[model samples]
Target chain A: MILTVTPNAALDVTWTVDRLVPRASHRVDQVRERAGGKGINVSRVLASLGHATAVTGLAGGPTGRLIRADLRAAGLRDELVPVSGDSRRTLTVVSREDGDATVLNPAGPRIGPAEWDAFTAHYARLARGADVVVLSGSLPPGLGPGTYAELVRTAAAAGARTVVDTSGPPLLAALDARPDVVKPNAAELAAVTGHDDAHRAAAELRERGAGAVVASLGPDGLLAHTPDGVWRAVPPRPLSGNPTGAGDACVAALAAGLAAGAPWHRTLCEAVALSAAAVVAPVAGDVDASVHRRFRTTVTLVPLEEPDAPHVH
Target chain B: MILTVTPNAALDVTWTVDRLVPRASHRVDQVRERAGGKGINVSRVLASLGHATAVTGLAGGPTGRLIRADLRAAGLRDELVPVSGDSRRTLTVVSREDGDATVLNPAGPRIGPAEWDAFTAHYARLARGADVVVLSGSLPPGLGPGTYAELVRTAAAAGARTVVDTSGPPLLAALDARPDVVKPNAAELAAVTGHDDAHRAAAELRERGAGAVVASLGPDGLLAHTPDGVWRAVPPRPLSGNPTGAGDACVAALAAGLAAGAPWHRTLCEAVALSAAAVVAPVAGDVDASVHRRFRTTVTLVPLEEPDAPHVH
Candidate 1:
């Protein structure tokens, strides 16, 4: 089983309007809400792919209840811990006219110190029964930057491989715990390593103690720097749609591959295909199954020289 | 006691951002939420003025729970009827840079026939103990245009004077029930009566069966057409802030006047002052008490020839 953790899960609300005019009143034609966060999205993708995935995270208040209810309705395993503050929400206003989306994200609820301690203990217990533990998304307020590092260490101690998908300080800090894998998109990789090149950034993250580094380059596809080899996997073709949850789809495929002890080349291929498939779907946490199936066999994988290895002529 | 009914009550959520750029993501700096609707605003104003006001209407689901909780926290009486459908929310995105607000309003829950029947029975019981019943705002989906008319008749049967504050078909329909007062803002009056002139539009509403008509004209104050006389009340000077709840404040004062059997002149003066005070405040259902007091004695009232009376000059 794979366990995914989203520290700051959200109730994602999407409102469709005839047209979006800034600073003007709009009558929403439709409203769609669902439980959302990086780890939850990863878990959702895994579930859709017939993987045994369980979600555990911190949630609270009325919004938290709604998130939990949605999780139950979606038939995803829920092990979210309770907090006192209301969970946050992300409102995406989609214009039916131009298909433009305006997103409003609230900083999630402040998690108390006791709540963090409770979550760590809960995560440790859950990790023991999991082959891989995926720690994803932003840390809520009152949580330290080293939050994922602590969870990564906990998972390691529980004899589970840990996949950390985050950015900035959390991603950098998680490297110290030597997580099995750290998946950062091109932008996220550069933000942490200060390297615009995905190859250098992934190598830098690996040197910082990450067991493996997978950098998702949107549309361009996946760059992997693992102990086995360095590989770049490109999608069969550019799929144009919403790119919101494409990274989560990549993480889902990576975690699945790790759980099955697959080779880096096969893992990167699947990750690239799934990410492209997610982009083909309109909403996050969903994939076009046919797109996934078609791209899976056609994704091109190219072996590359390891950045840190000694020069060979 | 004044009872205000908001059939389509909302949990108004305000998100403040540094700047609003269309089709771009915004990180909300502040989030504020409160129970809101025309009738709820009226009740809130009355409560703030040390009047006994109870909120009664149809509310359901999570948003309704939040509204009820807020009402309880505000120490106002809550007699809201519950339905199965989720209550709607209105999101206002305020840009701090220019102080521009973008509002997104959802068409509220569809009330089942059984729910409407339940609410009417509930309202009838609540109206019996009220001196005045104020029905305000839009009717939820699945409710007819005669919703307010039915409520007005029910209030009358319970010996309660009714103030209907709405527009279009609902406003026209409520008039046939002979409500004690129907308050429409300039635009609302124009929409319903097809008269650009506030004076003529208000008089037309009275001619249609309303016992009285008070048309709020924003910075210009109010125009009252009642059995006693026709009068235009203007504030001392234009004071502007937020005009969102000014009409509700006007209705609040009107309901207070009717409950106390105050004369039309005094009622119109108070209504104008309170409405301006609401404009001075930043939020709806709130008033700057000092502004209200200052404007009360300063409002200028002018008597006009009754529109429907025979000319004797």
Candidate 2:
């Protein structure tokens, strides 16, 4: 089973208003809440794809209880360690008029040293049974930048392929553990490697010991630099809706592909198709089933000899 | 002791952002949450003033748990009845630059018949020991408009002085139950009695069997129509800040006064002063202690000769 870890999980609340007027009271038209964090999103996508997946993370207080209840209701396997601080909430205000979403994210509950030790110990046991381990999202406060690095090393020692999706210092630090895959969006890639070009940034991550790099290019699709070859995959047409969890869906595809020992080209195609389908879904961490099925046949993947080139057809 | 009942309680969450731009993501600078509802707000203020207060209401789910935990942490006596539906949340987004707040209030958890029965039974038991009972805020779904009337009647039967703070039909109906005092803001007064004049509206309410009518005139302070006499109280000068909970603070003062058997004029004076102090405070249900003390000495109260006559300063 694939194991996903989200250190900073949250209770995501979505409020819909007729029109968002600054500094005015709004009679919310609707409210929707869900369990959310990068790894939790990834695990949800994998479970939808019929993949056996389990999620591990730190949770606490009432918000944490709500998250746990949601996970249970969704039938997603979870092993969340308790913390002293209350978990945070992420608010997304959706404008009913234009469907534009505004997000407000707060830093999550702090994880103490003792909590960190407990998490690491629990993860080591889970990692041994995990076929593929995916570490995603920001590190909660009280933990140093090397937290993901230590987790990656632990997974590696357990002989499980690891995929880490994060940004900046934590992503850079985790590279030394030689995770099987690292997924970064165009902006995150530039932020870490100081390269505006996705190809060069992926190459930089690879040089720092990432087994492969799958860089997401938003609506443009996925670009990969794997051991077998370099590949670029694009959807047949641009899909429009909420793009909040599209990248997480792509990571889920990549992790599933790696676990199933699928060929790189087929994996890239699946990642591109699923992410495109995800864009049309109403909320994050979910996809329209019919859209996903249709995109599978329409997405195009082109194998490239060199990384620094782009071809769209 | 004062007994406050909030049929529709909520976990109030506040987020502070640099600016509020519709359809744009906001990086929240800070977050603050508290247990809130109109009656709960009154109870909080009473607790701050060293008054013995107990809050009873219906709560369920994780949000309810958070509210209970906050009340416990604050050392407020509570007797919250459990329900099946989850209690709701109210979001207030405060703009850091302008200090303006935008609120989103959802209808709270639906209370089943069983839950409603359970709550009223618990309230009756508590009302026996209460000197003053407050029925405040909106009624959740699964209850009729006459819910507040029933509660007011119950408190009256127990010989507890009753204060009903609500609007529209609920307030109009509770007046028939002969509550000791009914606090309605200027707009609510106009809506119920079809009188633009606060004095006329308050007199109309007293004519309908209400023992007293304490009409909150916003920045102009309060206009009271009691058997003893008519009195109008205003601050020395208009205080400007957040006015969201000023009315609730006024209710707290009125409740405290009734519990202590204070004279009507003194009660109106305290209500006006405390409410003005609440206007300058950043949050609802709280007052600046120094501001409260200053206003206590500066607020001016006038004994009105007639109900329809206008008085400004």
- Against the true structure, what is every candidate's RMSD? 2.6, 2.7
For candidate 2, lDDT tens digit of each residue in B126-237? 9999999998998888888888889888998898999999999989888888899999999999999997877877889999989988988888888989878988888888
For every model in order, the TM-score on chain A comes to: 0.97, 0.96
DockQ, each predicted model: 0.78, 0.65
**TM-score list, all predictions:** 0.96, 0.93
lDDT values, one for every candidate: 0.91, 0.88
* Leading candidate by lDDT: 1
Off by over 4 Å in 1: A306-313, B306-313
Among residues 3 or more apart in sequence or in different chains, the pairs in candidate 2 whose N, CA or C atoms overlap within 3 Å are none
Q: Across residues B107-179, which tens digit of lDDT does each residue of candidate 1 receive?
A: 9999999999999888999999999999999888999999899999999999999999988899999999999
